[model samples]
Target chain A: MTPSHSGPSDRLEASLAGFDVPAARPPDFPTADVSYAVDDTPIGRMLLACDGSGVLVASLFTPDAAAEEAALQRLAARISPRVLRRPQSLDEARRWLESYLDGGRPGAAPAWALSLATPFQIPVLTTLAARVGYGDRATYGQLASWAGRPQAARAVGTALGGNPLCVVLPCHRVVGASGSLTGYAGGLAAKRYLLELESTSL
Target chain B: MTLPPFQLLVDAHWRDVARLAHALVGPDDGDDVAQQAWLQAWAAYPSLTSATNLRGWLFTVTYRCATDAHRGRGRRPVPVEDPSLAAAERPAVDPPATASDESGVWQIVATLPPRQREAVALRYVADLDHAAIAAALGTSTAMSRRLVSDALGSLRKALS
Candidate 1:
C-alpha cells in the first residue's frame, strides 16, 4: 500500500474538483449593497461600483491592486460591507463607459449613487453631471455658480477633488479659472488625455 | 495590518466555501450553507484581528454553518444514490465518463463519520495543510493527521 503516494487522497481531490459548484450569488441583505468591477479603459484600469439598485457609484482610476483595494475599502466603509466583485453585474455602467470612451455619446446618464458625497458635494456633482456634455469644459467658478453656490468656487473645487464618479461625473471637464487644466483624480496627464480625446472627437 | 476589503475575502474563498458546504452537507443544502457562512463572516469581519490565515478562518465559519444546517434538519442521513444511475439521470450536459467514477468516490466520502468527513473535505477540497485543518476543526495537528489518515484508510478499503 503506497500510504503517502497518489491513491485515495489523490482520487478524492479529483472527485472534489468534478463537483459543479455555481458562483456564489450576492448576499440578499444590505451588507452586500454594492457590487464592483475593474475594467481597462483607454485611460487606465478603472474600478467601477454600483449600488444594489444598479446606480453608478465609485469609478476611480485604479492603476494597481493597491489602488483598487483602497477604493473598495472606502466604499465598504462609506456604503455597505457586503461589496462583492461581480463584473457582469456592472455591465450597463461598463457599456456606457465604453461607448463614451469610444467618442460616442452614451444614450442617457446612468443613475449615480452619491452615498460617498457630502450634502454640498452632491449638488456640485449633480450639476456637473447634468450640465457638462462630452466635449464641453467649464471653470470651477462657473460650476459653483451653476450649482447655485456662487461664492463656493473653492468648495466646489474641493468637492470635485473627491469626486466619487470620475469620468461619469465629468470632473475632468472642470478646469482652472483661466481655462488651464487643473488637478484631476486620475492626475494631470489623464486629464489632458481625456480633454484631447473629447476635442479630437468633437 | 488593516483588514483587507471583505470583497477580497469573498472573491478568494467563496468557491472553496461552496465546495466544503457540498461535501459537508449535500448539493441541495450547499448553496444555502455557503450563503449563511458568508453573511456571518461579513458581520464578524470587522472584529477579526489577523488576516494571515483567513482561509482557515473562513473554513471554520463554513464548518460551523454546515453543522448548524445538519442540526436544523434533524441530522437525517444524506440520501446516497447509485453512482451510475445518478450520473446517467442528470438531464444537463453529458458528463465525462469519469464523472460516474468520481461521483462514486464522493459517495464514499459522504458516508464517513462527521469528524473524518470534515478532515477529508478540508484536506482535499479546501487544500489546507494539516495545521490549518486542525485550526479549522479545533483539534491538535496530530489529531488532524490521524483523522485524515483514518478517513483515507476507510476510503481505500471501501473503494477496494
Candidate 2:
C-alpha cells in the first residue's frame, strides 16, 4: 500500500493535536519534560507512541510500563514471550515518542500505515480526527449523525469512551447532549486544555 | 507463611495482572480479571514457595480469569457497533506528529485475530518472558510460541 490517501495516521494526528499530556502529566513517564504538560481532566498522564513516520498508539494515564504493556496487550492480544533487548526496528518510533513528550513537535507530518481491525472504529476515528480543534467540543449525538447513525448517540458515546488512543483519537472532544462534558479516561480537565489549545490555535 | 507475604505478592504483581487483564479485556473489564486472579493467587500463595516465577504465576491467573470471563459472557458481537470511532471529533491541527509507520507489520499482526495481539503485546511490550506470557495468556508455552512466530512471520512479510 502506497499509504492510503488519508491513512490512519491522519486520523490519529487530528485526534491528538490539541491534547498533549498535562503539565503534571507524570514525573515518571520515562521522561521529565512532558511532566509539565498539565491539563484539567480525569486522565493524569498521557502516552504517545509514534514510529516517527506516524503515531501508533496514544494512551492516557496508562500509569507506568506495566500500564503501557497492558495497553499494548489490549492492542495486540495472544503475545509471545521472547526477551530480546534489541528489536531491530522501532528505534525511530522511540525517538519520535521521546520528542513528543520532550515538548517538541515532530519535524514532519507523515502518513500512518498501521492496519486497523475494527470496522466501525476507523470511520469513527476519522470523524474524530476532523473534529479535533484543541478545545472545541462535539456532542455524541452530533458524532452519531456524522457516523451515519444519528440514533446511536449513546452508542457513539460508548465507542468514544472506549477509545484507546485517548488524546490521539481525540475522544475528549465529544461531550454530552446537554452540552455537559461526559466521562474522560484522562479526566475532564485535560479535555478542557485540549479544547483550549485548539480553540486558541484557531 | 503469613497474609502479609501473600499481600505483598499480590501488590507486587498487581500491576502485571492489571496489564494482562486489561489487555485481555478492555481496561474497564480488566478490574474483574485482576480481582479473580488475586483471589486465586491468594489461595495458592501458601505453597508458592519458590520466588522465581512469581510474575508468571500472577499473570497466568489474570489471563485465565479473563478468558473465563469472556467465555462466561459468550462472545462479544463482532463489528461492535460504534460509530464514534469515526464520528467522534478531532483535535486542532498541531505540529506534533501522531501518525505511524507499521501498517504492513500490524495489519498482519491484526490478522492473527485478537487473541494473538493480546499475547504479543503482553510478551514484547510488557517484557514478560515465555512463562509469564503463557501465564498471562492462559495458554501453554508451545501455543504461545506458535502464535508469536506466526505473527512475526506475518509482520516480516508485511514489511517486506
Name the top TM-score candidate: 1
**Candidate 1 CA-lDDT value:** 0.77
lDDT by residue (tens digit), candidate 1, A1-202: 1245675566765665565455445444343568888998888899999987888888898999889888998887787766888777789889988988887756786788788888999999999988998889999999999999999999999999999999888999999989998698888988998888888987
The residue-level lDDT of candidate 2 at B135 comes to: 60
TM-score of chain B of 1: 0.78
TM-score (0 to 1) of chain B, per candidate? 0.78, 0.59
Which 10 consecutive positions of candidate 2 chain B have the poorest summed lDDT? B90-99
Compute the lDDT for candidate 2.
0.49
The lowest-lDDT stretch of 10 consecutive residues in candidate 1 chain B is B86-95
Q: Across residues A28-120, which tens digit of lDDT does each residue of candidate 2 receive?
A: 111111111112223354444333233343344665567644544433331111111122233444454345334443443223322322566
Best by lDDT: 1
